[model samples]
Target: MLEVAVIVLAVFSVLLAAACGWLILSQRHLAALQAERDAVRDQRLKELSKRLDTYLTGSVRMGEELYELRRVVAPLPDKLTQIEQRDPSSLSFTQAARLAGMGASVDDLTQSCGLSKAEAELVSKLHHAQHPTS
Candidate 1:
């Protein structure tokens, strides 16, 4: 009876040792997977930072170009108004498109002209006064 009890104790010890070994291996595998995930996350963040830097630089360059264009066309408004007043009704399509960018409405004066939001409102009022739909 004593020998049988000793054999049972020895079997329990062997199972406990195997369980501990499996737990250690599982812990190592989990740590390795976590390390790989962290590396990928770091790489993605670096790529996003590089892309943002590139976009910001391009936007600044575009803004400078627009500023230069505005400076070059600074006198266009005064010249356009002078020509518009001379022959408002007979202005060409290109002239009206340009004037629309300014604060003028040549739509009522010339049917072929396009008007912006503000200019279109003024054109509506002038059209109503000139040719009222009574």
Candidate 2:
């Protein structure tokens, strides 16, 4: 009866050791899982921050471009009124000369600046001769 008791005691001790080892291994696994979660969270935060910065920079650039466009367009109405009310015939020769320098076609010169067909053709030829393309 004493030997049987000793055998049972030994078996119990072995079972306890196995349970302790399992517990230790489970704790280690849990720690590793927590560390992995932390790393993933950090990476996601960095990526989101970078994306937000890029978005802000683009928005600022777009706002600046809008401001510049407004500045350029602010005087367009006044200039249009002046052009509409001016005597076209008075400035026809000068306007034709400038348009020819800017690569205007003969038809455009004749229509916009009231040049005759022959005069427009002469201006186109002279301007083209001055700034010839290869």
| Candidate 1 TM-score, C-alpha based | 0.54
Q: Best-fitting candidate, measured by lDDT?
A: 2
After superposition, the stretches of candidate 1 with alpha carbons farther than 4 Å from their true spots are 81-134
Q: What's the C-alpha lDDT at position 106 in model 2? A: 90
For each candidate, the alpha-carbon lDDT, in order, equals 0.64, 0.77
Candidate 2, RMSD to the unseen true structure: 10.0
Per-model TM-score, in order, reads 0.54, 0.57
Each prediction's Cα RMSD? 9.9, 10.0
Stretches of candidate 2 above 4 Å error?
2-6, 88-134
lDDT value for candidate 2?
A: 0.77
Q: Give a tens-digit lDDT track for model 2, residues 7-110.
A: 99999999999999999999999999999999999999999999999999999999999898667656644543454357554777667768988878899999
Task: Give the per-residue lDDT digits (tens) of candidate 1, residues 11-108.
Answer: 99999999999999999999999999999999999999999999999999999997986675555545545645766675453454544444454445
